[model samples]
Target: MWKGLIKTNRQKEFFKKAERIAEEACKHLTKTDREASFSYETLKVIKDVKYPSMSLAKSEGGEGLSLYELLLMQEKIAEGDGAAALSIGWHMGIMMELSQEQLWDKAAYDRLVKQVVTDQKVVNRAATEPATGSPTRGGVPETKAVKQGDQYRLNGRKSFTSMAEHLDFYIVSAYVEDKDTVGWFLIDRHQAGLSIDKTWDTLGMRGTASDDLVMNDVKVNEGDLVELKSEGKPNAKGWLLHIPACYLGIAVAARNDAIAFAKDFQPNSLNTPIAEVAHIQDKIGEMEWKLMQAHSFLYSTAKKWDEEPEQRGLMGSELAAVKLAVTNTANEVVDLAMRIAGGRGLSKKYPFEKYYRDVRAGLHNPPMDDAVIAMLAKQAISKD
Candidate 1:
């Protein structure tokens, strides 16, 4: 817990609120982020409790949490539901960049931030295309944003959009209007011609509603082009990896779940709790140990960025290292969680199945481990 977050006679109440949110989320831990379904009740709890606004500056109606502390907050919530953690993470992570860069008209930023905190809206980045691939791989978008009178017409098929269906607005990527530039347009989902093409069938993050965003000439005003660039490095936007932090939180959550389960969950033949089993205890111990090491590497790097705000954008080496380390741990921790669940883990009724699929998403995320290793090797050899 970061110092001074909830300072009042209400410290007990705050923890109670926090615990209640975790409890509510725990009820749906098995739901697929792809569930992409809306829950007014759940969303209301999040807004009232204020986790979406966790990263927002207190001065700007946010919690004023530092990046490192925000990461910790994300970890705590994710221990309950990985998808909700990420759905919220995507919004906060984007806001951090907008604030850092001072993009958009002040009014829009203000309204957007408020909506995020209030649960009135959600924003996501749409950057993938069928012909190309992930925006991560330097794939240029076939999606075109054409400038028209008083507006821009955007046409594209974007895949792998996180939280696509539920978004109120999307900062969609396309070849710049009649140019070779990469452009990002902030188109509202309510605008005509923007539609969710299909429900995503991803194995993980199912509750996130990670769906395909389709635009067959969506119209947008100049206000929509929040960012435009003729040329730049693909990795210039480093804030994207804040998402990995959310995934890391999921691992932490699974670790906690396993430990608590071990305390009382008894197998058919076991007269006592599984905590008494040496092998089970060892598995739990090793997972905790791995989490500590992973945090040591991750937290230090995050703190370095916060303590020195000048460092922004992704360094292939550092970001890759963070992604590789945390994601792998998430996979392992979740596996141990499933193993602890025994045969029950494989069933849909068990949250372990959902956690298993969700954790795998980390491994596939870019910068893929191989890419990171190769880049690190190059950097090491070159520097040496």
Candidate 2:
């Protein structure tokens, strides 16, 4: 069995819970992947454990886990089921961001946090749109919110709303007509005009339920408007490290399966197991080296985010670089594992195919590789 990086009792407890959740969630992966359906059972387990609220401050009735801890948990969960990890990662990241930054309206956010902690409800931001592309690209939203007496009527569609099947509250982004700027509105799931479009068919991470959110004149309280769009570059988001952590977990899964196959399988032409073959040993060595590099890059960066508060604001490039490097390294590790396992790796009897597909999805997530590289390039070439 592959060893984990956990060192302390606190992380040990969290890793155990995450491992249990992953084991339970893995049972449904084949069915979900084949049918492109979601597993509500997996979500029930997560909510029962209150995994989403673990990042909240201790004063706010949460475990107050650090970024490194949360990322470690996220990685562990992804080892069993990437889709489940990806879906829950959004909720965990959102909760952490809210508690750490207090970027939303105080009263409204406090009420929402109460509901989240007590009711075990989950929240995720609905920001991407069909026309505007990714929100990270600085595109103005096509969704519009018009003020009407003590209410704001929102009518537009949000794409890639992950965890849509179970999201209790969607922090939706829209153009506030009165304010002439984009703002985030905390829209309730039970709102009259809100509906899910269920159009999340994809090659990988299909179980994320990243469908479209359709709002037709949905009304929200005036105070539900949580945050307005800010000018200039956004702050460094250390919580997004969960994205690379997930892919790394998938890579670890692939490596484990390949090692097992190499140890057990023996061809008639060879008296010994393939694990003893020189070329096979080479592949395993490369996989281990890459995994070590990825693990170091991800955990060290997350530890910095947790222990050094004063430097976080200036870590935007470094944080994105972690995502770019770890995710790409994960992609390589999965591919190498597939090679070691041979053609059978692609068969449904094995899981390398799934890991291969799922790891690629991280490239499409926010703070895309091209964007991160461009930011780094400009930072290097410009005058200090």
Candidate 3:
């Protein structure tokens, strides 16, 4: 197992801490999902552990952990509670990106990192506009950031702003009037003209608090603008592995539940538990097979990204393939687990229904299945 590969004592300690925190988070997941509310308690636990700062530089008040370690921690958190993992994953990813790329202005970025380290501030990129859909689709954002004398007035609405109410900062993407280019502006939650509509009623991931963010001329400093490279090509980001890790954790939870239920569940007519049933065993085996395949791909890609930084530039296709495979397999595993549990899976008494819904959300995450396939095809054809 990858855990055995963790040689350093610091890494092992961090992994143990993550496991403990995840267990605590799992205790509240039922109530968290039932209310369809953000898991503030879980967030508090994560904050107490300072998990968000795991990826920042040691000089920047972080543990200076590798990307692989961060993904492992995220998977553990997702096993306990998928919503909490998804919400915190944004903060961790953003911090990691800022730590490595230094894309944002130094002073502003430093301040944000300080806030994350000291106050446990939560932040996420609010880039998905209602008109533009996913930014990956290359739609021009309608969100405008008009330049003032020393500030930019940001105006427009953003959708799927996960952890909306709990965020201290939002890395908002908007069309800049002066540059005629789309850029990211860091906006604080307390800033005037910024409000959440609480319109996040969704089929799954209800606890993500993915509400609509309405910005009515929100004001931010000129320095708040994050600089972008002239080239528009997307860079390989290992942080995205957190997405697949979350779904895989949820699938693991579902599989464990199904196995336990099967071992104990006995029908009135049947002399043995459902574990003795061939059909039930078949479903469990299938789920295990899918999980193993997904885990191998996810960890191997993460390890490669960590060990071979120079090769990251050419990993776009491989990264997309991992995301597609892991997410799709997670959904399949959860479905099989549900099947093993029979009608109980559909009942509110079990967690399979929630896992099913949450795992499906991964299909809509970045590197959409259709786009991944197209990219793979383009790469293959070009090579030939």
> Which candidate's lDDT is highest?
2
Worst 10 residues of 3 by lDDT: 1-10
lDDT of 3 by residue, 31-83 (tens): 76767678777778778888877789999899887878887888877888888
Error of 1 at 362 (Å): 1.1
Q: How many residue pairs clash in each candidate?
A: 11, 0, 0
Query: All models: lDDT?
Result: 0.72, 0.90, 0.86
Could you tell me the C-alpha RMSD of candidate 1 in Å? 3.5
Which has the higher TM-score value, candidate number 2 or candidate number 3? 2
Name the candidate that leads on TM-score.
2
Candidate 1 lDDT over residue span 1-384, tens digit each = 223333444444444555666567767654444355544455667767766665667677765656666566556567667777677677767777776666677866776777776664667788878788767688878988888987889888888777676677888898875656888888777899988877577667777667789899888887777777635554444455666766777777677667778897987899889989999988998888787777776777766777865665545478678878888887888898888878877886656777788778778767788888888899889988
Pick the winner on lDDT between candidates 1 and 2: 2
Query: TM-score of every model?
Result: 0.86, 0.97, 0.96
Q: Cα miss at 182, model 2 (Å)?
A: 0.2
Candidate 1 lDDT (Cα, 0 to 1): 0.72
- Flag regions of model 1 displaced more than 4 Å: 1-21, 30-38, 104-120, 230-238, 267-271, 311-316
